[model samples]
Target: MIAIVTVLLAFPLGFFLHNRTSAYVVYVAIFGYSFTFQTLYLLRAWVGGDHSAFSADPEKLPLDYLAVTGAIYAVGFLLITLGHRLGAKRRNRSLAVDLESSK
Candidate 1:
């Protein structure tokens, strides 16, 4: 659910804004929110003496969480890049057509 919302929002911002920076801004905002939420959840579970977050191995969970977070960040970046590229291509094509028509 969160992933879907993030992708939908980010892609449109990238596409409609037609700015590379906007994609990154969206990426940073999404990544920050997700990282903070996960960290808070882990901290809460740890403080509550719930080791379920750690599963059977206490030492491995942090690494797993980091890996998953990295994957999410990477995917978000790829989506934003794709949107930005497509938007730029469209903008350029339209600009070229307008120029030709003007001439």
Candidate 2:
């Protein structure tokens, strides 16, 4: 659910609003939220006195949670980067056309 929302909503909004302050906030939230949740998962067992978060056994790692969070982070970045590239191209083309017409 969180991943879906992040991809469908947060990512595109972040992309289109890149120049605005809200976009930076959204970027931080989406990316940070992912890692935070994953971190919580890794540390869940620690609260039970099982072991420290850092020294937890590799076999007990929250692989699925990490994968989902990572996927969300990657998707958000990819979408934002793609939008920026496309927007830049469009802006450049428009500027070039405007310059030619003014001559």
Candidate 3:
């Protein structure tokens, strides 16, 4: 569901941005956390049990889910930044070689 849509969007963005590896890594991280959170949410909804002592109410959602989502978003942004830096480095090296040849 949510994981599927996230992958679909990430894949094309990766290709278009020429950062497939970073994109895939971020995608995996995002999907992994999202799935885990969703599972916990579902369990809390159905099982009516609180596995963690932090929450008094079994029906209450965990605050960690929000933290996980934020972490994923940060990872994705970092990946994009790294990918752009790598691509720029490669481009610069190629340009330097071309310039030297013309000298």
lDDT of each: 0.70, 0.62, 0.58
TM-score of each: 0.67, 0.50, 0.43
What order do candidates take by TM-score, descending? Answer: 1, 2, 3
User: Over 4 Å off in model 2, which ranges?
Assistant: 18-25, 31-59, 95-103
lDDT at 41 for candidate 1? 85
lDDT of 2 by residue, 24-71 (tens): 567767667766775677578666666643545556766665676678
What's model 3's TM-score? Answer: 0.43
Question: Which model, 2 or 3, shows the larger lDDT?
Answer: 2
Q: Which segments of model 1 are wrong by more than 4 Å?
A: 1-5, 46-61, 95-103
How many clashes in candidate 2? 0
Q: Which ten residues in a row have the lowest lDDT in candidate 2?
A: 94-103
The order by descending lDDT is 1, 2, 3
Worst 10 residues of 3 by lDDT: 94-103
For residue 47, give model 3's deviation from the true position in Å.
2.6
Looking at candidate 3, what is the lDDT of residue 55?
A: 56
Candidate 1 has which clashing residue pairs, if any? none
Tens-place lDDT digits, model 3, residues 1-103: 4435453555344544655665667676767777677766866755666554235665676678567555655555554555556666665675433445553
Top lDDT: which candidate number?
1
